[model samples]
Target: MFFVILLAQTVIGQKITGTVYDDTKTPLPGANVYVKGTSKGTTTDFDGKYEIEIDAKHQVLVFSFIGYKTKEVKVKGKTIVNVTLEQDSATLDEVVVVGMAESRMMKREHVVGYSIARIPQNTESYAAIKENDFKDVIKNPLSTFSVDVDKASYSNVRRYINNGGLPPADAVRIEEMINYFNYDYKAPKDDAPFSINTELSACPWNKDNLLLHVGLQGKKIPMDDLPPSNIVFLLDVSGSMNSPNKLPLLKSSLKLLLESLRPKDRVAIVVYAGSSGLVLPSTSCKDKKTIIEALEGLSAGGSTAGGEGLKLAYKIANENFIKKGNNRIVMATDGDFNVGLSSNSEMERLITEEREKGIAISVLGFGMGNYKDDKMEIIADKGNGNYAYIDNLLEARKVLVSEFGGTMYTIAKDVKFQLEFNPVHVSKYRLVGYENRLLNEEDFEDDTKDAGEIGAGHTVTALYEIIPSKNNSDKENRLRYQTSELTSQALESNDLITLKLRYKKPEKNKSLLIEQSVQNKPVAFTETSDNYRFSASVAEFGMLLRDSKYLGTATWKSAYMLAKDAKGSDEEGYRGEMIRLIKSAELLSSNKQE
Candidate 1:
């Protein structure tokens, strides 16, 4: 049949192949691969093998992917073109959360380490404990929150946290990671081969918190700067969203999301109360009168049929889907799928299938008291989407309006980080966080495995604490059958940790690599680094709160202290809010105990 011949040709195009890896040697699951200059791509299976046939018209094939580098190969249709993707040192442009105006030195001009005091450094006595130790910590995607704080041998964790020794009085803080940035970075406009911009801020919630903002603009690629977006605001007006912070705050936050859409982009307001019903169908983005009217009509009262609502929203999106345009479904809810196909797994399945059909999901979580943090995180992770918590309206703008590229576009998918310690330079190392994103060492080289995605301008940061072999005075565990023994001549740790990142472009399947390094001695604590400091602070805060086994952290008090001390030239109000959050968390913890 004519159809059969077409299918054969489709399968016979030039074949290009490659392997992928995280900083560690693990096969990343669900990574995507495809040829450049074409719309054909396939995802890496569990084993990470991919082969797609493309025309050999231009023997040279361009391979691109998210998180990794973009490689161009001049192949007379080579069957195997193995590639190793590196990490991207540049970060995306987004609203950098610096502590708020509370600590804002408006009149004072900014300098690298201005208004910063040197850290009083003294090693903790407990640091003299047995060299290699292990501890426990719970982890998952999106975020980590736990009720039980202590259940493992922190061992030197306290020593790791304490500046000298004793309980921590400061929380190693970074507000930018906590807040996410406000703008998506754009490539450079000049012809100067390379360009870069960096930002720094203190925590907004805790006095000790600090936020760093890093931006890297690549060579400008001419593309249409489309007007706003045709966003469909879908609200779940169900009984489960009855909490004061849930539905009520959600209403207020939705108002902020609305502000981002312009009249040029079409927007429709949809809400699901007792059953699925269209409060307002598709409308113009500029028609605020119609939009607000529909939004105000929404209220909480009735069982939720989330499935029905989602189906209807997708219908509307498909009908109004913009080809080569940002057509998105913004879902705001507590993630209670009680009414229909409500299970987290069910929602994930539905969203996964929908992503291939071209509709994207953006989840904005509201409230605190009874919010489903885990459920929310999963839905976002599996849905090929971005998820954020909008505790207030200001946060709503940050997620909905501010950073669009880092938020909406998919630059790479199934991003996994892995690293291999050179026997000559390293002994033992511990990845700071990402307990959930870990992969087997073998998986790193497997290009077909699925991992995480990097947004258009987003920056992924992972830190590891390593102990040098020379510094380690412990017995070595030797491997059997090998001529070499660990005791013979163990290599020391690298003075710097080599950072490796891999990714696939939204339209292509083949992956590329980018790499950079971080010195173990670390930059001066008081020095200015908008991106690293903010990300570092977030990692510290997450560890402390979750009671991490290897945490260099503690209670809210110390967390706040670290953020405060790290406060640098924080033009953004992120750091200020971190201070407030510390105070709020302290109070919340107090009230819970009572």
Candidate 2:
């Protein structure tokens, strides 16, 4: 009887295990195997085998893997639980950040006809998108210009919430750039150029904002062992970041980032408040438990000390810089660098030095109310990084994970656009957007001129409204030479305008050029292509919102009505969101003029 009891105990103590594989039968390493949320999880070994302790405690086991989605299975009182992950088709929204601004949707086109007024040439400016023709309002507003979707490549997108569970106004937000499409982008199958397809049909609401049909085909990143990444989490625990929307949302955002990291990566935490200090030394990705614990203990307090924080972060990053691995300092804050490096020049100098050492920076702006937009711009620009504002969780997912390549990896830096107008077919022309990014025509050919960067798969779009010289009607709008003074005889006869683009390949100091021309044709604004229609909507929206003081007779209602009429079905639902946002804005302000 004792021997029988011993045998039974031995049998009960036996471990049950199996390997987890994908549909391809490939061993899935690093898969998470957990029994609910008991803080107990065992990762599969290199061979994907698990010898986890099994008692009467667990009836269902959960399996999760990144990119492949997640799953759960009931053991049925048995011992083994094998999981197969399916790709999550319902992806999150993308965050689209270009240069130093939020890419927004626009609704009007500024057609340049010969203006009888002193300004001449129909101008597309803050005057075009203003809300109330108010000088200050027109010059600066919440958002400006249409996102470069049709032109640029997908960079990132935020996670999706059911039925619009977006983050609060003060939280950080990002959108998933590729959720709108399905890309099987494989490295050029045979080194031929890979191309994505995009098309447009008539727009529903606004016939002008035509429906967009895009199918992108691109070369894929060949599967290879990625260089080990060394990441420094430079967090802002400043007093201004104490709001629930700031610190709490920031924590959740970083947690999402932690989830995306692989076991081979290393992360170090450096935090700043009244001053800066290292919270956690660099640790392997496998040490997720300790890292998460440190993250949870973080609290927001004390005045901001950005200078101190940056120095310490650089020190830690330099200590662990990888020869070829990614070394990035992700700074999260509202760009309030007071108490230290308060001046832009000093901060610029420090960041410049760090950039020279190949330590890149990515600035994530959090919180509002006391948000410092100008500071964020300066840091991101000089830090060799870009700036993004997270108004919600969606933005977090976009920035951290979606289209990670484009946002984190640049294709070309210092891209500049220059257009030389011809006096022949076109009497005059007006550039529709990019008031801030404008460069002198001479800079278009100069590689040394500081310009914008473009990421892999990024497409850039710029538009101009032309006035055909044949139409005597526009003769009034052209900025007539006060006395035909400046132009030499040779300069007086050039077609409509020549658009020039200059850019440098990533890691290359030299520049390349591309040019296209437009003849002043009978093409009226209404007669332009779908691309023009969509672009017009963008320009008009900017003008109405800025409340340009130059808006003599135009009003918000008219602009909104035009946009509503031009907006299409918007199967993606972006158009619908626009209607809601605009309507809400109209209602929020006291100046409601029907």
Candidate 3:
């Protein structure tokens, strides 16, 4: 019958594919492409290419990008649709108020007094990082630190490199860069929340030394199995966020997140400007239209009252406290908090107090100029949550859609790592990155100490560079008053280190323990897994950026080569993008030298 044929036509959907370009014919990466009226959509990749399926009922495909005019074309008779989006003239003449004295319509292209373009002063800030130093195994055998799954530093650095500039030294966090990519480790099969994997291999930067890779793979839970979420959105609509990359991009990025939520999940909207106020009360995801409307109604103006916003958000979360559920605040901002309770210490103290009440806060940082990365990182760390930077729609999709469960669900909290090296096998060792996350040795076993949280399906990686016992010269310089002797078991055992991990269940206060013993046996660098090689490459890249004294023989060319070969099975093209970013960094670094 006609109805049966119509159903058959709908089932056999047609595929449409094409590339998106700007007015200059330059490929526009991260452009949005979708069926006009449905959630079936995709973003253009690094090459500005996209492919989406369409049925008879959905024949129109819409292409859109920030600052560009959206275009919709019919795909009924076409197999391909290439789009060239022109800049919106209306947006160029729109008025934005930057301060009390400055309120004027700015053009997309502004003219300077002379032909030379005016370069704006950079106001971005990052926390100072003192790189970890070597520790003698005989003197300090144990290395303790909290696990970090934050990926903000990596994307922030990428934004810098893509803008044709080298990032500030403190902007590069090696561990975050290494962990930005996914690794293939076996998932936990038991009741444990996560599985630990370790690898020993020759150090790529120093052939005479060794590299120890420790990875934790949080158990993956299906979307249906995840606990219902009570999410409060703490959005910043201050005047500083008036740029195209700030408020507008944030609104679009959050809309993409809405598609991933379920009917059982609830969301509330809170905004901070000259003052803080609630835009929408807690509402179920089933009423997505109301949520979307509230988001679209937001406009950037006034000073930032971030502290007041946090207090109100936490208050609402407490009022709607969902016991045995995921209660969290997803704060999106450029981190420029200039109003009341704006100092770093004050915000930290406030967040520290609220975290004890079973409410977590994840941070989604956006924008560039006047950015406050230092504050956002501190907030996320103290709030028992995670942090990520969204530089584009593609990155937003990665964080809010593809990794929805990992971004929203906490499987374990207060995850800590402590490694005790065997002096008989290793003379000295230094933890790579995580300088700020290092903890006192005794703090590892203390249940009251705060640490990091690992979300469902999140992978945390750490690296340590070690020197073999045979290369030690400390014995010759040992103090005459103190003579150390090795144990017979230490000399006979093949273990190089004993790794210990502690973590708590999402709703529990007490911590569970996981212990692993690493063997002294090591393989050649080339024989190691892609996970080891790729992570080493990222560490080397970070060193080059920071100009670290401990870089050894690491070079930009070497990092690029290592990453090129180890970018295995990058289905999402994230690894491939990292490879490109490496190449971009090399060019920028070389130009700086010139």
Candidate 4:
């Protein structure tokens, strides 16, 4: 009997191995493989190879990857099961519409010159973005901008790519894409809330130029040490959110977040559609069953009364306000607000006015075809909060569960950055991917001015493309009347740039300042850290997607190689997924060219 049992155990624990590939015969790295109806799973490596052990009862294996159709095969006692996935035809057939739609099935039109142009045809909108141009250091030595922790752009771009399409040029925000992945940086050892790090190396695209990386690592506070939170779930269950991915996926995502809450935390439920109402009063985490039941009971119908919903949510939060606690509203929706106060400026004004009362509102965007990204971004920015787009259940887990504290609590507000470049060492410079966040020089010191906010455990990164003074030695048209001479500090000192930062405590009204100086030191591209290389790769990818005019020598092939080589210590596999995305984009670009 013992011998027979051992043999059965060995037979049931058979190992299965295979390599996943796409239709083009290219290996699909980061593909997921698992046994049906089982929790056991593994992801393909850089070589598209995966191995998993299965029980006798679960002989069927499933293989899936982004941008490709999922395939399932019954092992039928076979050990090797190599599989090829086809591109999802339904995803590839999705078309890009530039305007909005009053209803899901209705289209609006306008006259453009002699032709008829569609207006609000599909309802998706993205705020237009203009790339930054090279600025003469002699003319403008100082560059200033607000720090942004919102990461909506990267995931939204991922959605477009995985759906077999390129994201609109205006939708690609390079800074957000780079900051999506975390970098290893030491925590602050002093009284400061964050630490600053800098790196300089040869530009990967333009070898003649240099790239300067600036990183800020926010202090990490353990969950036990975090302040008590008072949260209001401001959900939109309008007719627009009736789709399976919107309402059903959202409910599942919020359930995962419940597992992360502590007993000391409290939550309330407020829903809006054609009308706004309170579904649940402020309830303690101890009563989790009630919360779960309320979430599960939500249904989508009626029009979107987003403005009224905001007002009611803020009112409830203020009424149950916890002193010095994290008071926030997590609003989930597809951002389709056509009923009341729907304009971006109006929403911004409303949020700005209410944020002064010590309540923050973060936006969780969902759905795709009729998504209103522009409005959500504005509201989140003006409300002293962050924004994230949840494309799938996994993304929901990432935003609501994995990053609960960072997404819910704010450590610093009104965060701003100013850098003064030394004209002696740098002639021309361009601040990449912050055209919208750029602030005037005078706004840096103004306490009344509103800037960006940084949440706990958040990291903000910015890059600058620089042209050394040696390359600009020949002046085209030196000002004949007035010539600006380099200062003694610029000539004698080896400083490259001086970085200045300002931020306020979440509950404080005044801002605090911190400053640091970076010396002139350039390392070879091969010698830079993984963080530097990975971020550079993302920036290059964004530029390629946008078809930027400043793309000096960047190619899709270079971006893929850089990301694949620099994918170090990716515990969450996000960096590996980026490498795969680069490959997918490269194939799409090549096919388009052909």
The lDDT per prediction is: 0.49, 0.52, 0.85, 0.83
Write one digit per residue (lDDT tens) for candidate 1, span 401-500.
5555556555555554544443333344544444434466556556666555555445444444444435333324343554333323223443233445
Each prediction's number of clashing residue pairs? 111, 82, 0, 2
Model 1 CA lDDT for position 216: 37
Error of 1 at 209 (Å): 21
3 or 4, greater by lDDT:
3
Cα-based lDDT at residue 255, candidate 3 = 95
Candidate RMSDs in order: 24.2, 15.1, 8.2, 7.7
Q: Which stretches of candidate 1 lie over 4 Å from their true place?
A: 1-228, 242-244, 442-449, 456-459, 471-477, 483-495, 516-534, 552-558, 583-594
Best by lDDT: 3
Clashing pairs in 4: 100-120, 100-123
Best by TM-score: 4
- Model 2 ranges off by over 4 Å: 1-229, 263-265, 323-325, 467-495, 519-532, 549-572, 589-594
lDDT of 3 by residue, 95-213 (tens): 21211111221231221100222236789999999999999888898999999999999999977765446789999999999888889988987788998999999999999899999
Give the range of the ten consecutive residues with the poorest summed lDDT in model 4. Answer: 107-116
Candidate order by lDDT, decreasing, is: 3, 4, 2, 1
